[model samples]
Target: MKESVSHIQGVGPRAVEQLEVMGISTVEQLLEHFPFRYEDYAIRPIMEVQHDERVTVRGKVHSEPTLRYYGKNKARLTVRVLVDGLLVQAIFFNQGYLKNQIHLGDVITINGKFDRNRLMISGGTMKTSNQEVTGGLEPVYSVKGSIKITTLRKYIRQAFEQFGDQIGEILPHQLLSAYRLLNRRETLEQLHFPTDTVQLKQAKRRMIYEELLFFQLKMQMFRKLERQGEKGQQKRFNKEDLLVFMDKLPFELTGAQKQALKEILSDLTADHRMNRLLQGDVGSGKTIVAGIALYVNAKAGFQGALMVPTEILAEQHKASLKELLEPFGLRVELLSGSAKAKERREILGALKEGSVDVLIGTHALIQDGVDFHHLGLVITDEQHRFGVEQRRILRNKGLRPDVLFMTATPIPRTLAISVFGDMDVSIINEMPKGRKPVDTRWAKHDMLPRVIEFLKRELGKGHQAYVICPLIEESDKLDVQNAIDVHHQLTQVFPEFTVGLMHGRLSSDEKDCVMNEFAKNNVHILVSTTVVEVGVNVPNATVMVIYDAERFGLAQLHQLRGRVGRGQAQSYCILLADPKSDVGKERMQIMTDTNDGFELSERDLELRGPGEFFGSRQSGLPNFKVADIVEDFRVLEVARQDAAKLVNSEAFWKSNDYEKLRKKLEEQGVFQDQKLD
Candidate 1:
């Protein structure tokens, strides 16, 4: 199984290269390339098969299959076969090799989708004699360029025959019996070639359990190690001070906000260092909770720092923090890459001398020579935007400061527990009083005029609107709209109103200028990409028009729609999309059905899986090959419990049985830099 894929029969150089393109380099990798889906195509009578249904039929060809050419490189093969006294015709597109592979009087089985009176077996599995190619319950693997599912299946079968017994079991014998799971080798065998639905289900259960259990074990281990060391600062909060700060707010905090603040305040005074995650939906009043933490830290004679992703967000936080804390005589400062040299020097001096009670900035805060007098709390806004190493660099500036990570993207509770298992989580599920839900509408491309008129009406009412495009420039590959082209067309459509364009290609200074104009209402209609998905806040914006809305995931669409509806007036999110696929249309329907981010996130997971939920690079989701959080949630729960028990038990770590497991986890690199080792 450890041999190169080239060692397999029929896997020539071209085939090996194609297989490597799909990440199958070794025999083990080929075996682990599980099927994305399965179809039951056991041989059945052709007469009984319904139209438009897919089935497998066994019969003998009446005559040799012949190829007909339409062009130099285009051809089709047609074959007539007799199945249970019923005549059926099978057609294959661009497959001229069937002339040599299948002949007259050959007893072959073919799997295909049945049409009105023909079996259209385009790229179907074919087996000669009495042996079956796919057997029953055909497995369909993900394919790349020039690679067919049949080819993958053939190679995998050879691998199993050669190395099936060499596959070692990773799970403990006790667990195998306790969970009633098949051993590793048997599970692999059944998964690749299942005879019945029950066999497939059992094999899938074993694989899913193993994937989820390993991830849970790694995360729970991190959680256990976090509590073992590192004494945190004991910053006690004065009730009178908190009440005085609360009175200064223009609006009262909701019960949910108060509860989240209470939890944060409690963590600050605890002896253990606080590693907490604060999750809330867009416009759910998370800023105030973070503000309270900063104020409390300042009152305890420790300076605090808040790091944001963008410079505009840094300036916004500085302004808001100044307004909230300046009356109480707390000094606040902003540090950014664009800051003047003299201004930066002054701010750095203030930060080091403790005159700056609270400092807010982008990554500029972590620059060399920027020292803190007594940094006690570190608040990171939109935490997912920053990498693990970046967060560590900021935390290292202070002596084990209390870390509070905040994100507006609402993750499902089960996923949140598994991903951020190392940190204590506080969710603000409730919105502020008098907040109205955004009126959402899904429109087709033909309704562009109506959507345009609606935007005009909102603009006439003195409210601003936003227009988002998925792409920045026109490309030959994609047919979707681009920000540049959309900006030009929009300018022509609405000559009276100012239209602006913003995307990733623009410089930071240029983006800041464009966003500032939109925020000031200088540009009535802003055309942009996902750059505004996170930290841009404009209360006057009341209408959002997302071109090609089907291209975005549910959470992204929700976040874009959230840009509007922040003001008092009624807001509307007009989604202009006419997706041709059912999955795309279903995503659009989910967007229109609810304003709840968490609910939409779960639906997004179910529809597109976790890879799309959070992109592969930044997704906090465990990178499991077979485990799906939405479908295997029950297994995930069991794994979480088992992991917690193992991490807590003193004997498990000392036993030889878990030595290899521990080594594999160490080499995985996810836990390499953690304190657990």
Candidate 2:
């Protein structure tokens, strides 16, 4: 690869600037810019090109191209090509430049999908060629508006020709031979300019394997460090302490919950650091499992801290833990950013002196002045909500504290192994007995009145409801309904009932007051945004009415539905969305068809990809340029096994065979702020 893309042939300064917009500044980056889709350039006769099929046809222009205008500033250019006395119409939308490029009786090849009528090929690639077939296939890249596909293809071809042999293999020969993978040079060549579908598939597999293998290597490195190198504070606890706490609970533990608790307890007793992820669906009793871990830590004469994303969640955890464990002589304290100065000082003092056994709070727990005496366990709720640095800071409070991360979001096993590969994972798939599935449905806008009546009936039955909207207020930019407008509308529609409004724009105190009212059932209807997606848990709220539901992802819709169905009463989730697009309809149907969070999560990953699956702000997900965690699970397994084999070998660490691999991992920044010492 050349030092810069500009050094390559045909990539001038302007071309370089445009390429940089697509994240290509170097020749290697240009080579790595794999095609997102492919076009079949195997030429077919003009009459044989089927409708809605992408194909390439070479023929002579039978007549002069004609340009016609539709609306203001909109024009369509039409040209007819003749192949063996058969005339085929080819239309290009807004491509007036085609009049100057082609003329009467000019031979050319067109690559695009035939329109539904099978008479014309619209919005496709056009190149001047006398041959019938351009090649076996063509690479179609994702390009900027100003950069043409032909330009990108030309530059990339030059890059490969100039430095193709210079692209050396990074993987060891033995490993490559074992995997039967092609070298980098061949992979890049086939991916960009493949001769057949089989070659393309083989080259794609090689690249995917390389990406996943390197990612797995880094993750395993972290795992090995945590298990073999990091020292953790091992706490000593009597079995009776857990039994006593279990006996005090008002409910029975499910088998899954018991298994999770057992695994966490086993980790706590181990000499190595306990870095485990506790994954459970909403209302699956994860908090109780965490409560048990905290109790065990306290019983061993150590302090444990639980961090949540919001103050309301922190408060809920603190209250619930205090009620459950205080009878067992455990002192629970709540600290958050919203706590008063006096309260913060008091809590800090008690925490430093070891009087507080379990502390539950938000980011305030990791404040500079906050200290813990013999801090042993750290539990973080909604693991993705916090950054790695934030969690590290909390862990740094103690001398290698045993860490337990908890997430109410049900992650698929494949995703769990990829994202949280460094941590031992424990899943609580079973809900406690008596929790019924929420009845979910999607309705059109015309069904709003019926939906409102349904909510009224639920509210009349002594239950509460949540009315969620996509926006906070009216926006000229977006046509979706807003929470504030919905709140007023609901208030006017149901004058006899009390409706409350809540959104991110509200102050902390206002949010707390509104939520408190809703929880106490003082507000029969709570209208809010996705801000209530996480912390607002009211058992009496049996109905969730999400407006513009098509605008929400499946995972978030599942979370909103989880807000209901927490009590003995039957619950319902009514999704109101305009199912105009196929994607919209598909998402709505998925929400209505299943209540399984794990299934929805997997489907979400499939439909929306990883970035939107958990959301863009989600941390810890690997940024692989080619590998997809959902589609490449099989490759990931192969890579994971290979990484394990390497990490297990004692000689590999000191041998020169893995020095390049080690340096690559170090340069990847996968180990953030890790001390080499």
Flag regions of model 2 displaced more than 4 Å: 1-30, 46-51, 59-96, 102-105, 118-120, 129-136, 140-162, 474-479, 581-583, 605-612, 615-617, 654-660, 669-677
Alpha carbon lDDT of each predicted model:
0.85, 0.84
Name the lDDT of candidate 1. Answer: 0.85
Query: What would the TM-score be for candidate 1 when compared with the true structure?
Result: 0.86
lDDT of 2 by residue, 1-677 (tens): 64899899778899988998888898888988988878887777666666788878788998899999897788888899886576778888887777888978788888777774657787886877544455678788888758999899999899988988788777877788887888888999999999798988889889889898887777788778767776677888888867777887899999999999889989899888888988898899998889888888999999999999888888889888988889888899999887789988999999999999999988888889989998999999997788778888998999888989888787788767666666789998887898899999889999999998888788788999998999999997889999988988999999989999999998887998899999888999999999999955798999999999999888889989999998889999999999688988999999988888888877887788644555554566657666776678778877888888888897558788777777677677645635211
Top TM-score prediction, candidate number: 2
Reference-based lDDT, residue 144, model 2: 78
How well does model 2 score by local distance difference test?
Answer: 0.84
